[model samples]
Target chain A: MKKIESLSEYRALLGENKKTHNGIDKNCFLLPSGMEKFISAGKVYYRSYDQGILIFIDENSYYNLYYYIEKGSCFPVFSCEKPVLIEELSQNGSRDAYIAANEARLKAAGFGFYRKSFQYEIGIGAEEPQRFCTAEDEQAVKASGFRYDTACYADFRPQIISLWKESLDFGDISGDDLALELSQDEELLTVISGDGAVACTYLYEIVGRDVSEGRHVVTNPSYYRKGLGSFVLGLTLDHLRAEGIKRHYTWIHEQNIPSVRMHERLGFLQNGRSSIQYILK
Target chain B: MEEMMQILKGVRPDVDFENEKLLIDNKVLDSFDIITIVSEFNENFDIEIDVEDLEPYNFNTIEAMWELITKLQEEG
Candidate 1:
């Protein structure tokens, strides 16, 4: 195995391996551009193997590598600067087989299962219901002076980062990483803010042909149960629809019942895809 | 080509893969269907269909998919 040092080399290796394997891992296949950013930031380290490659994000970074070591890939044998989390996505029915095949090697490497999430998707059809905030909720938001709008990262970087850290447990994402993400598109982050406080936020990205993934949605605990979560998510769905996105995808932790219910209430359905994150810390 | 059509139809029985020229752009087939089709093509034709070959233009119609398969086979 050789460490990939340049983006061009990474791309070439990826192409060659795709031909050899008949297909590349979906995460790696879709993440070249993001990899470029992370590489430039000096936050990504990856090594190429015959079956596939293994990517590692810096221990202090928030950029999660949703990568899988192919079924027959060389076992990862590298050391990390800090505790590393390896997240793997597998088809629901194959989850057990996936674990059975890799768990031992992972355990030998001091990694253990961290968390699991269920993947859900909703297709935008002509007759699909348009669910947004109810009239009472809208009135309440207006009365409280809270308004939904696209946030300028430069203006709300501190609050955004603070709220992100406060509300989510994905780990510490560097501000630079957040900046890189927001720089991808001006309208990627939407927020409901009032009186200098960002109450709710939604971040999404176009992941594939006509498909958008809702990457993150968070509401301040102080603003919980005020319908801010639903309001922002509803508007995001509308926004994606207007941008010609036909399918929307999101992942919710298996233990996050409230979030799962919220997504289901808005028409998202489990699509038999789930992922487990393993960490060696 | 007929075998390819059968594979495509087997994966998505309701779609008219032969006539429809926008299987991907029109969102008629999702990612799962594409994965199944790629696996079938690779196994049946003994051709390696790389991720780069998963563009919409190569899968929007039955003819396009057949062209991709033939090209890959010739290369192989």
Candidate 2:
């Protein structure tokens, strides 16, 4: 596995496999638009194999593996901070090949299969201003005494961090670092309680002109079963629809049956997309 | 304890909640399962278990969950 560093090197590698590179499209593999983002990110690792090129983008605790096989075939594995979560599968690779390629190394390093996230992409329509919240959801929010507020980043900073801590189990994520990333996005929706935030979700611009990435739909675990998750998701979807965003895409863990159900209820399709995660102990 | 086990089984009949103690640590039960189980506990016991009480330690075992309910009920 050779480390692909410069743009020239990456391009040369791609040039070696032009036939495979040409087949990728938005509807298929998650091919990188450019190597510039990966190179500049500074933690990216690349290697050339007999039939494909392996690219690993390490985002501190989370790492994304992009295995570009010959003929434009690609597979991606998105990992959580602790490396315990093996997420996302390739559209073209076989399960055996995927496991053989990475499973041994991951297992030797102490990880195990945590969960799987099913990717969803939806086409948004220009609907009238309507509520996505259910009666039960509204009642739960009211009973819990949390307020829905569309506040600026400054106001949302401290509360959002706490919510992340309570919802996500990975301890490697630093609240300060997360705050820095959250500041980059322009849109946010939050459910707040007394002096704190209970639930929140945000949207960030993607590479395409009208596509936005829906991210970090988190709620404090203490507030679970109170409809906070649905409330936040509904508010975010309504806002996105109003913005005329053509498509919305997100990954929901297979284990989160309620979330999957909620998204389906909101009209997002399963799309028959599957990703595999291999955890090591 | 039996009641808690019954509810757990009802939510996830496939899992042997009586024997599986690593429910939370092993990720056997996902977030949604935890949410459902918590809701059931709240409704059946008439106790409000806030998010702060939702740590993995409390839901890892039927015994731990029963203890949590008892504590919350007594506190109320």
Candidate 3:
């Protein structure tokens, strides 16, 4: 449990993956604030293994561990040799084999039972013109003092990723180019504060007619209770409904209570589908 | 029309609903706000509104909202 203080050392540990988990790149363990907190009070731990380096940040209350494997799909489904918490935050159609490999470590780390959870696929039917926003919503947005914008995600990828990581269960974010490609979709919506996006939502995969798969409903942590979610999503879904988008569906993690509540309040009924999350007790 | 304004104020008290004509285009009222308002309208007028009718023109002004309600009522 030694501090890997140098940036070069941290990069070498991650093997230059250029990917991020919880706003942490290969270069640093914590963000600027988290780093400062850890430097002052918390302790960063490091251990080298055959497959990769295990970097752990002990922030007193909870510990965050990462195993930067050198090769193979670092996606949880492929490799879980030194597995971390396999929750909704990073489920990517993984097979049982990877979970099987981490059994020893899972037990060693005192991980609890294998519980099943899922990201829901719920739809908004075009039968009712989805007027999901109200004048109160407009007042709420005005009160929050954030402006709504569309198709501007490329400019705020980092902020977007940070917000999502802070709120929703998310894994490795797409690179800048991929982020730009996604934002270019004419239907994407964003709410901006200061210089960057505070929240965003968009649809993908034109299934049939005008129906699409929606995802990435994220709000900045600082702006959570300010009704920004209602404001931005209200604008986006209305526009989507108006676009003759007969139906809009999104995947929500069952454990994400706030998200489920918001979706339900916005008139999305849950479809009967789920996935399993394996744990070792 | 005044009734609709009351409903609008109930959901969002701060907005000057009388002056704001471009509710949708100007980003005054969001989709949730529209949904809240529409749901209120459906309950009050006893009319079913479809997604196709949820256009900006239908919600931009109090008069537009009244016209939409009246039109939907007439259709019924």
Candidate 4:
């Protein structure tokens, strides 16, 4: 296997694999610009073998490995300073083959199945609207000096990193990743701040002309039960609606009952798609 | 082109679409803005703009957008 340093070469190899494997969807992989940004941020590492390419995305505490195999065989070998997560989107049928091929290596590396997450989706106007935050809650939040606004990624990078470190168990993002995403036209990071602290944050990506994905939402643990999450999410949804986004979706772990309930209350329903994560320490 | 400018202004009044050539590259227009523009163009021009036609090259400037709309109308 040879290390791929140039973005053009990486793209060409990916394009060749796509041309050969008709079932592969390019969208499943990170966009070229995103890959370039991550590489520039020094957070992305990738290599190519005879059969395919493997990409390792370095988050602060963990790594995410994404691979494209030409012969339908998937096995990635890499060293990491922290835990590594390998996720398989359920929409792809090759997940079974991928796991089968990598099972032995993963076990040898002390990896185990982590958890299964279900995808939830909602149409902007397809269903009757439900208020995630009541007028009273909004008024209270506002009166308390908590204000919601969209901001550049740098505005709350430190706060977000701190909050995710304390609250999130998986898919924790790094400041470099956030900085890279800020360069994209479709990424939006909204926040609620007051009293010299960021109370809550919502980050999403506009995936298509009328579709957006809820990437991450984190509220300072100290602000829990204050309706900050609901308040911020409601405003974010309204912003998305005004921007002509017709659909929104997100993934939540099945065991996360509170998050499941909150999303359900906000009108998101399970979309019958699920993915599994395998983690190696 | 003036009519197109009107539509663009209607979506985002702050931008000077006439002189700003790098609408997509400069981040003058975001994905949301693009969606609104596409919807407006499709309805106003009675031309179908497929997802394939939503590339940055076709929308980086008023001239590029007009050319794309004209091409789509001609194809129709």
Q: TM-score of model 3, chain A?
A: 0.49
- Write one digit per residue (lDDT tens) for candidate 1, span A1-281: 23456777766766665556643433333324445676676766666655566666664553344343454454556565556776655554533664567767777767778888988888764356664445676678889998777655567778888777666675434455554566676338878888888888898877655677888888988888888888888787776777777778898999999999999988889987677777765
Model 4 per-residue lDDT tens digits across residues A154-221: 67677776676676564544455555555567788888888878888888987754667897788897
Q: Which ten residues in a row have the lowest lDDT in candidate 2 chain A?
A: A23-32
**Residues B33-70 of candidate 3: C-alpha lDDT, one tens digit per residue:** 56457656866787755434666788778888889999
Q: Alpha-carbon error at B17 in model 3, in Å?
A: 45
Find the candidate with the highest lDDT and give its number. Answer: 1
CAPRI-style grade of the A/B interface in model 3: incorrect
Clashes of each: 0, 12, 20, 0
TM-score of each: 0.73, 0.55, 0.41, 0.61
DockQ of all candidate complexes: 0.23, 0.01, 0.01, 0.04
Give the range of the ten consecutive residues with the poorest summed lDDT in model 3 chain A: A21-30
- Worst lDDT run of 10 residues, candidate 4 chain B, spans B27-36
Alpha-carbon RMSD of each model: 5.0, 20.5, 21.4, 10.2
Write the number of the candidate with greater lDDT, choosing between 2 and 3: 2
Candidate 1 stretches with Cα past 4 Å from truth are: A1-8, A11-44, A48-74, A92-99, A134-136, A151-154, A172-176, B1-76
Fraction of the native A-B contacts that model 4 recovers: 0.00
What are the per-residue Cα lDDT tens digits for candidate 3 across A1-281?
Answer: 56767544554545433233221112121223333444454366666544445566652333455555443323222233332343322223222443455444445556544445444443444677446777777666666666666666666667665555465432332233234435454445454564344544443444334555565666666555766665666677676666766556666666678878877777776543334343321
Report interface Cα RMSD per prediction.
Answer: 5.1, 19.5, 19.7, 10.6
**Per-residue lDDT of A224 in model 3:** 57
